[model samples]
Target: MSHTPAPSRYDRQPYRRSGRSGLLLPTLSLGLWHNFGDVDRHDTAREMLLGAFDRGITHFDLANNYGPPPGSAEVTMGRVLREDLAAYRDELIISTKAGYRMNPGPYGEWGSRKYLLASLDASLKRLGLPYVDIFYSHRPDPDTPLEETMGALDQAVRSGRALYVGLSNYSAAQTREASAILRRLGTPCVIHQPRYSMLDRHVEGGLLDVLAEEGIGCIAFSPLAQGLLTEKYLASIPADSRAAKGGFLKPTDITPGRLAALRGLKELADARGQTLAQLALSWVLRQPVMTSILVGASRLAQIDDALGIIAAAPLNDAELAAIDAALALENATT
Candidate 1:
């Protein structure tokens, strides 16, 4: 499909600086973790990509193992780049990650220098780009030494295959050590991706502090908690919902207490003139360390809803307290 992005693509939406880096990312980014794979409709994926760009979402996040079959999301993105967004390449911040199981054999996955570098090469091939704006180590490899993993990330930048390096799913201590290693190597870990949402506040425990202290940007993924934060599960889970599909989010995970808590959150969202998802997005971004929130969408409307938070007012102290009270009530009930 021929595409012309909106003339004022960067007008209203805001960009946040990634850590102390000079890079500025749109406050909201699109993640291709789901619904952009080979199993999904090509037209829909293409439409969402173009529509998002038209709405000023410049960053597109992907991982080597994002697709149901693994690596297909990048192929889909590559096709979009080649067919539609090639001329606007420099206007985009395309990122992808390694350190997940992408294939068989020991060298096919993990944080080994061999796996990390090799994965970047393959990701570059699939993305159809000489280099990605940010390349991440998807997770910390237990067996692989941290030095080895960070070394590969350093190599990625030095080789000009990636402009900057990032860490994902790393703990607070791990992040601190990794940041030091990257800094020593002159790469200075620009960003860290962690699963963060109202439903999941694990990052707040210490990871956010580490990122803040290290001056590394935080781009939160799963900000909707795999769609649980939305109204999609207020009453019943949709037939096509991720929970119904029995993967990362299971139907059993949505209990009555959780539903009740979400309902309370919905009330707050309604009062604030935003959707529950928007409220959730705004909540995670309340942290000063947050550079961006990665939102995964199955349709154009979902993209619009996530973008809605960009204009909505940030949650005030009273609203934040109410959210906490509701969550605490849920925990007590459960």
Candidate 2:
């Protein structure tokens, strides 16, 4: 008789190819952008991560400066990976960045070779991994030459510290230059992580084109506009919302006009029998160039909601037209 292994809980979420790469990423990726910091409960962070993976979130986004105390998120993730997720590391796509300030000296941050190499080492130590699947430059450094940063990223790949190299928060033109440098260094940039949402469509300005021309994947962050795209603020900011916590989401960003527009969006989402957060996420992953939507969840249930959005399917022309109209008004006023 043939033996059948028990089904893993992660058999649900759908996966899509990340750009033109050989790897396939889940449509929804969990990000440790906020609340997974030093101040948050370790158990809660682990639960959120475990719940996400169980629901098929194979990709996890983090940066060296992710914590309030800096590097705490990675340290926390390291514990979870060791305690519960170690055996499944091959199934995980872990990414970390290093362009931000991590130390006091000039060489301690930015795109210089010294900072990049050293920062990747520190991140690896905190992550407790031999190599991360993807290593990002975090952001563009104006003062530092692009070659230096790209070169360090190449070294990270060549030395087997990171398997793939990516750039984050870089402009369309900047990405063009960075790609050239990476190509010369023999490390082709695989992806570009950018902040994109219904409200923040700046990447649509031109960056998506660069990503396509270079065959790089686009992983969108803040697809829900830092919770502004969710029904959580349909009435008013709740006590536990990011705005209330004075974190990444700001109070001023939630103007009366924006709220009214969101009410319309909330109604639209209700008509589809889904939450505004789900719809907002659905909108981002709709694009062909989009590899994944990087989202943050404070609770396991929130992760459940995110995973539910992956199989929502394509939006019809009518829905797209309505979204375009509503978002046009919002953008005009912004």
Candidate 3:
């Protein structure tokens, strides 16, 4: 490994402290939920990751089952880590989750002490690192006792496998339950990664409130709503869009009414001299606890475009009202 980093391969983006925590994550963090896997272009992944780092995106998020074949994304990240960012490991915040399926067996998935602890160790080995900046429980497992699940995360921190622990896709109430356990165990329950976008106001159902009340940080994932909130879907699902993909996004989900709302949102974006993707990201990031907006990029340009959103001004009263009207239309049919 080189003694120094590769001549600053990334630009520095704005940084915000995740809640009141000492950690300052980049305003826009990268997630390996899709397209960083086995079949996706390796150069694209490398360039995007490098571009993000050059732009000061220090935090990178991943899960055990992120790759198309499962675990390939982490392997690829590991390769990148060794090849490019090895010297700068101390400055990066790399995180991985384990609640989702990684194997077929009954104990292969879910939030158990056994599964999370084992999964983190596997992730660490694949990343070629002694420890991760943060480790998250991918989801709430109703079958497993929250205590046991929470204990798993607590163990990760105490065992020196992960510096801090986080929760993902967990509801406000469930977050409290798990958070309570982790806090009692003396583990730093630092953040939560949740899906939040204009099309998905599910967080308003109390998740954000709980995070706020607890002083825990939150990174809103899929801030583009899987690209549906972007201008790319205004006309029709482009063959290259997520909608065009056979899974995750369905054609039926993009109804005429939804398209109209999208159009209105796009129009709003155009009026502001910004793209819909930027607008959607700025909207959700307006919240205080909105520590970082987790984004996925298939190209360096897309990542740059998202980074430009940091310059976006806060939405005013009129913009908020207009957005509410658009959401009303969506509620009627959604």
Provide TM-scores for the models. Answer: 0.98, 0.95, 0.95
What is the TM-score ranking, best to worst? 1, 3, 2
Candidate 3 lDDT, 256-310, residue by residue in tens:
7788788788778888888989989889889889889899988889888987787
Cα lDDT, all candidates: 0.92, 0.86, 0.85
Which residue pairs collide in model 3, if any? 10-53, 10-54, 10-55, 11-54, 11-55, 11-56
Between candidates 2 and 3, name the one with more favorable TM-score.
3
Give residue 75's error in model 3 in angstroms.
0.5
Per-model tally of clashing residue pairs: 0, 0, 6
Error of 3 at 127 (Å): 0.9
lDDT, model 3: 0.85
- Alpha-carbon lDDT of model 2: 0.86
Distance (Å) between predicted and true CA of 162, model 3?
Answer: 0.1
The numbered model that scores best in lDDT is: 1
> What's the CA RMSD of model 2 in angstroms?
3.1
Comparing 1 with 2 on TM-score, the higher-scoring candidate is 1
Best candidate according to TM-score: 1
